[model samples]
Target: MVSFGIWGLIPPVLTITLAFITKDVMVSLFLGILSGTLIVAGGNPIIAILNLTDMLAGSLNDGWNIRIFLFCALLGGLVGMLSKTGSARAFGRWAADKLNSPKTSLLMAWFCGLVIFIDDYFNSLAVGTVMRPITDKNNVPRAQLAYILDSTAAPVCILVPISSWVITVMSIVKGSEGFSSLGISEFEFFMRSVPFNIYAILTLIMVLTLILTGRNFGPMAKSIKYAKETGKLYNEDYGPAPGEIEVEGEQNSSKARPMDMLFPILVLIASAVILFPMTTYLGAIDGESITSLGAAMGSMSLGDAFNNTDASMALFYAVIFTLLITYIYYTVRKLFTIKSASDAIGDGIKSMVPALIILTMAWTIGSVIKSSPEDGGLGLAAYLSEVVVGGGFPIALIPVIAFALSALISFSTGTSWGTFAIMIPIVMPIVVGLAQAKGLMDGAMLNSVLISISAVLGGSVFGDHASPISDTTILSSTGAGCPHLEHVATQMPYAITCAVCAFIGFLIGGIFLNLFVAWLAALGAFVLALVFLPRIYKA
Candidate 1:
C-alpha cells in the first residue's frame, strides 16, 4: 500500500482547470480519470488507459448506479413522450389563455418549476416551453424568463428530497467513507441538511421577490426596461433567439390537452411516493409474506420507512411503470403511433447521454479518490482529513470554505452535479476531522456536518446559475427563446446577490454551528437585498 499524500489532489485540480479552460466537461472528466488511473497504475500510461476503461465500467457495475441510470433514461423518455405528444405546448397554450400580466406569467413559470421537481432537465425545458408564450404576450423579457427557469430548475431539485438530484447526491454520499462515519442513513442526513441549504432557499426567495414586486437590479433591470418598453423579448443587438428545436412536429397541437403532460407527471410522483414506503416495508419483510398493505404500513411509521427506503430503486421502478402507462395513455389519445412513440423514447434516452456520461465519470473519479491504498488507489479522504486536522486548519470555517470553493468549481466547470461529485467526497472527511479535533458535542458536530454539506449543495447552484455553459442555463435560454449569453449576463446579479447572502449565512452558521439562526440570517439578508438593492441600483 502506497500513500499518495498531496499528490492525490492532482486529478481534481487538473480536472477543474481543464474544465474551466475547455468549457467541455466530458473531455475534462475523461482527462481527470485518466490522470487518477495514471497515479494508480504506477505512472504507466498504457496501464493507466486500461485502468480508466475499467474504472468507467466499474462505475456502472453497482446495482444502485445502474438503477439510477435506468431511472434517468426512463424519466427522459417520459419527458420525450410529453414533447412528442405536444403535451408541453398544450400546457403552454392552457396557461397562455389565463395569464394576462407579466408578473403572473413569470409566477406561472416558477410554479411549473416547483411542480416539475422530478428532474431539472424537465423543469427548465418544460417550464420554459409552458410559460414562454404567455410571458412574451405579457411583455416579459426573455432573459427574465430564463433567469426564473434557471433559478427554479436546480435549486428546487436540490431542495426536494424526492427528485433525481436527491437520488444522485445520496448515491454519491452513500459510497463515501465519511458517510459511514455519520451514523445516520443517507436519506436522513439529506433531509436534515435541507434547511441549511441557504443558497437554494435564497435564490427562490429572490426569484419570488423579483416576480411579485417587479423589482430588478444590475443587467436584469436594463434588460427588463429595454424589452418591456420596446416590445422586444430579447436584444435585437444579439440577433434572433435560437431555435427551440421542438422534439416533435405538434401534429395535433390544437387537439392536445394539458392533462397529457400533467397526468403522467402526477402518476410518476404518486407512484414513487406510495412505492417508497411499500418497498421499504417489503424489503424489511425480506421473504416474509405480507398479506395486507394496511397491516404492513401500520407496522412501520411512514417517516422511518422513507428513511430506510432505497431511493434509487424506488424512483427507477416508479419511472418504469409511469413510462409504460404514459405510452399507452398517449397512444390511445392518438398523439403518436407505436413506432413514433418508440422513436421519441429513443431520442429522450439520447438526450440523457451527456448527463449519464458526466455521472459515470463522476462516479469513477470518486471511487478512485476514496479507494484504499491497497486497492491501487489513493486514500484521499483519510489523507486529506489528516492533513487538515494536523495542519491547524480552522475547524469551524469549513462550511464557508466549502461553499465558496464549490461555487468557484461549479462556476468554472458549469456543472453543479459535477462539482458535488468533486467536492463532497473531499469536504466531508475534512469537516468530520475538524469536528473531532474541536472535541465538539455529537449534536454540534452533526449540525456542522449538515451545514457543510448544504453549503456544497447551495454553492454549486450559485455557480450553475451564473455559468454561461451550464446545461440548465442553456436550456432555460432555449426554452424562453432568449440569447444564452444574454441570459447569463442578466442572471449574474441575482446569482451573486443570493450567493453573498448564502455566504453570510454560512459564515454565521459555521461560526456558531446553528442551522436555525443561519437560515434566518440568510433569509433576512436576501429580504434586505430584495427591499433596498433595487432602489439603490436603479437610483
Candidate 2:
C-alpha cells in the first residue's frame, strides 16, 4: 500500500467537484471509489479494480451495515401496506376536513413529519403521501409542501433520542478511538450533544415561524403567489404534475377508517420506545451479572443503560413486530386478503430499491476511506489527526470549520448519512486529542467535542435540505407532486437562511464555549434574517 498523506484528500474532493458538475450522485460516488482504489493500488488499474470489488463486498458483509439496509427496506414495506389498506387516504380525507385553511394544512403536514421520526426516508414519503391532497385543496403550493417534508424528515430524526439516527450515531461514537477512556457512555455523550445541535433546532424553529407568519421569500414566494392567484402549483416552465402520488384501497370495503392507518403507526412508535428501554434493562442484567432487576436498574444511569442496550437488534425486532401486527389486523378486518397484503409488502420493498442502491454505494465508499493499510485503504482519519496536531490551526475554531466542511460535503454528495460516516471518525479523534493536549478532559473538552459533533450533524442536514439530488429532497418532491427542480429552487433560500445562522452559532459556541449563549445569538440571527431578507426578494 502507498502512503498518500494529504494526497488522500483527492478522492473525496474529486467526488464532490464532479457531483456538482454532473449532478449525478451514483456516477460521482463510483468514480470516487475507483480513484481511491487507484491511489491505494499505486496507480495499478487491474489491482484497483480488484480492490474496489473487495471493498464493496466487505461493506455489505458487515453485520451492522446489513441490518441498517434491511431496516430501511422493511420500514418502506410497512408504509406501502398502510397506503394499500386505504389507511393513508382515509386519514388524508379526515385531515382535510379538519384543516380547512392553508396555514393549518402546512402545519398538519409539518406535524406528521415530526410524528414519523423513526427514519427520514419514511418521513418524506409518508408525510407527502398523506398530506399532498389536503395541501393542494387549500391552495398551498407544492413547493411549500416539499419544504415542510424536507425540513421535518432528517432534521426531526436527528434530534429525537429514540430514532435509528441516534442508534447509528451512538454506535459510531462508541467505536471511536479514545472514547472509552473519556469515562463517558455513548448515550450520555449523545444526550449532551442534543443541546448543541443548533442547525436542526434552528431549522425546525424557522419552519414554524414561516408557517405561523405565512411569510414567503425568494422563489418560494413566487410559487406561493402564483398558486394563490392563478391556482397554478407549478411554474409555467415545468411540466404538468405527475399523476398525484397516492395509494388506492379496496373499493368494496366500507369499513376502512382513519384508525386503520393511525393504529399501525402508533404501534410502530410505541414498540420502538418500549423495546429500547426493555432491551437495555435486560442486557444490563445479563451482561453485568446483577442479582436482581431492580438493583441492575438502580446501578446504572440512563446513559449507561442505553450503552449496554443492543439498539439495532431492538429496532429490528420492533419493526418486525409492528409489521406482523399490521398484517394480522388487516387480514382479520378483511381489509385485505392475505395474498393482496403480501403483494403490497413486496411493492413497498420494491419502492425503496433506488434508495437502497444509493445507501449501499455510500456505505461502500465510507469503507474505502476507513479501511486500514493491510486492507489496501488510506487511513484518512489518522492522517487528518496528524495534520491537525502538527499544523497551526486554532483548536477553538474546530467546530466552525467542521460545520462548514460538513455542509459543503453533504451539499455536494446529497447524502447526510454518508457525510456523517466520513466525518465523525475523523472529527471526534481530533477534538479529543486537542482537549487532552490542553489538559482538559471532562467539562470544557467534552463540551467542545459535543459542539463539533453536533455541528457535523446539523450542517449535513442543512446541506441535504439545499441539495436537489438528495434522496430525501427528491422523495419530498415526488411526495408533493412538484417538479423536482422547482422544489430545490424554492427551498434553497429558506435552507440557506437557517444555515447561515447555524454557521454563526457554531462560531459563537466554539469561541465562547457556552451552549446557552451561542443558542441565543443564533436565534437572534435567525429572526433578523427572516425579517430582513424577504424585502430583497419583494423588490
**Model 2 segments beyond 4 Å from truth?**
1-4, 37-51, 60-62, 161-188, 231-234, 237-239, 248-254, 285-288, 291-303, 357-364, 374-376
Tell me the spans in candidate 1 whose CA falls farther than 4 Å from its real position.
287-299
lDDT of 2 by residue, 141-240 (tens): 8989999999998899898865656666765666555566577767667878889999898888889999999777888888988887898877757655
Write model 1 residue lDDT over 173-279, tens digit each, in one string: 88875778678888788988898999998888888877887888878898888975887789867667878657444786777888888988899988988888778
In model 2, the Cα lDDT at residue 408 comes to: 87
Q: Which candidate leads the pack in lDDT?
A: 1
- Clashes in model 1: which pairs? none
Q: lDDT (0-100) at residue 66 of candidate 2?
A: 75
Weakest 10 consecutive residues of candidate 2 by summed lDDT: 245-254
**Which candidate has the top score in TM-score?**
1
Question: Quick one: how many clashes does candidate 1 have?
Answer: 0
RMSD of each: 2.0, 3.2
Q: TM-scores of the models, in the given order?
A: 0.95, 0.88
